[model samples]
Target: MQFFPIFLRSEGARIVVSGGGETALAKLRLLLKTRARIAVHAAEADPKILDWQAEGRLSWVARPVEAADLDGARLVYAATDDAAEDARVAGLARAAGVLFNIVDNREDSAFITPAMVDRDPVVVAIGTEGAAPVLARKIKAGLEAWLPAGLGARVRAANAFRPEAEALPQGRARRGFWAAVFDGALDGRAPEPLDRLLEAHKAARPAVGEVLFVGAGPGDPDDLTMRARRALDRADVVIHDRLVPAPILELARREAEIVEAGKTGFGPSTPQEEINRLIVGRAAEGLVVVRLKAGDPSVFGRLDEEIEACEAAGIAWSVVPGLTAASAAAASLGQSLTRRGRNSDLRVLTGHDVNGLADHDWATLARPGAVAAIYMGKRAARFLQGRLMMHGAEAATPVSVVENAGRPEERILAATLGTLATEIASTELTGPAVILLGLAPRAAARSLPLLQEAAR
Candidate 1:
């Protein structure tokens, strides 16, 4: 971000503003909310500014700003309306080594103000680096409506009760207490006192850590579920699969320990047993652990083995489902996995397993209008083609391979079952890909010349 948002302590600090017209009036209205000492320098002042000076809200000088006016100021605002005057005042503020902003002039300003939703200690600042002030104001208005008016009072009570809340252990215990307080467990209007709430929290048992099997979703960060996002935010350790994109992994907490437990088709992989042990060991240490897998964990993710390991170790576990690659690939192809008059059932198949090339109900898959999403099928393309054809599958059956589905680098290769193996080999398919059996890109999607060439 070009501009970082920060809340400077304004208490007992001096802020200088160089302007006298409508621009200066607009800024003074917001500045009056702060506890800072505001000083306005203008040769001729607006009536409202003069009234504010009379009301002792700020100090007004009847002259243009000088270099000495910026001395000892925490911040300076040049809202002189005229570009030349604002620029001149800005130069003075810069020479004085003070951060300054030129109202309505973001290009030359050292700092910019953000639209704010003021809830005292719970202030929310929305900034667009001066790119879209109207959008920023819209966001602020939404937040103002969403946040309760009494939120500041609630926060104040919680702040006062913090010392007592600290009696609970840090990490989970403390976080849980604060979460409960904000969730209306200690209502400010309720008869139960904050001290009583603190005592009750202190009496509660300590929380144990658990493992959440989160689906990272087909290499796209946007496809992540809210539950999965929350799991990553709270995770102390994240054990992720190799195919999980780096952008998704970046969502994890900065302090979170990331471990790569990746498995590749026809390539070296971390032992499943070792991965299970790692999950159990981290949870046993009272750390919130996340086993981040690409796509849906239940679908070809070897989820059962890891759950069994957690069960054997008496470690608690849960699953956060993610959008599977099959769905994303189908979406990218502008097709569906199942259609009413075409396919009544949808099958998710694996290309390879412990027994080498995975075998499936090839006869059923060979039926007319049959549809299936094949995972890890890139390396076993020839084996899959041979088996399906041997089981009476049509030679002209449409097949589409989506590489890195839902990702920016995604590619779609279309072919018929007759040329499935050849097409895959010729393409030198790399990256994680899924094969769509009995499906092709919709006509509209085929407008792309590459897909049209493949279809032809």
Candidate 2:
């Protein structure tokens, strides 16, 4: 970010503006909302400036700005509407060690004003680093419509009640109490008396932590569900898997503690029991824990075990579904997991399990037009190919292996069942990949001129 957004304490501070025309008037309109003491320096003043000066809203000097005038100023705005004059004033402000802004000149300005939604204590500032002022204003307009006009009053009431609310224990209890109060207030209903609310909060049982199994969605942040995003935002501890991408992990709060409990297939991995214990232990400490997994947790993720652990420990748990890798891979291939006239049922299978290469009903899976999305199938390609072929599956059946589905470095390797293992080996697939049995990229099929070529 070129300009970090901060709320400067403007109360009782000095702000200098070196213009008096429309540009200066535009800035003064917003400045008047602040508590800062505004001073305008211009040889000729606008009628509005004269009115404001007469009303004592601001001090206006009937002469050009000078270096001495910038002393003790917290901020200066060179809105002279003339490039040379604005630059000259900017130089003086810089020499005086005051932050200066050149109106409409972002490149030369030390600070740029943000579009704001004013709700008194509930002000929201929207900025684009001066890249898109129109977009910023549009966002401000939307927020202005969404936020309640009475929110400021509610905030004031909460501020007044804060001293009594602090009597509750800190951490989750205090936060929960405040959350309940604002949640009710935002519903537009008349607020309950603060004393009654405080007594009710005190009488309420202590808050207990819970676990949310959130799907991170195939290595893409955009694919994350709003429910999953909210879970991450409120998470106190995030236990994520290896396949969960960094971009998705970045959604967690900065104060959140991140723990990597990745389990790789047939490779070095953290024990499942240990992961379950970690989830239960963290939740037991009254912390909101998020067990973040890639893709749909119920699909291939060992979700049942973690839930069982939580149940045994009497810890509450919930699930937030995500877009699975199979769906993303199919989208990337321009194909569907199931088609009306082709496959009636879609099977989601794992490539390996505790015993070894996971065995499925090869008889049904070998049938013509059978469709399946096989996760963790990269290393088990040869085993899968041999089993399917042994069960009378067609050697020429189309198979596509999608590596890093929905990610920037995604790769789709198209081949027939006959060459599935060979193609996988040749590609040296190193990333998490899914195998789509009986499917090919639609683009690749369309490129073939002959019907027979396209069929293959």
lDDT of each: 0.89, 0.90
Per-residue accuracy of model 1 over 246-329 as CA lDDT, tens digit each: 889899989789999999777899999999989999999888999999999999999999999999999999999999999999
lDDT of 2: 0.90
TM-score quality measure for candidate 2: 0.89
Model 2 lDDT at residue 309: 98
Output the lDDT of residue 55, model 1: 92
Q: Whole-model lDDT, candidate 1?
A: 0.89
**What are the models' TM-scores?**
0.90, 0.89
lDDT of 2 by residue, 237-276 (tens): 9999999988888999897899999987777999999999
TM value for model 1: 0.90
Off by over 4 Å in 2: 253-255, 389-396, 408-411, 426-430, 444-456
Index of the highest-lDDT prediction: 2
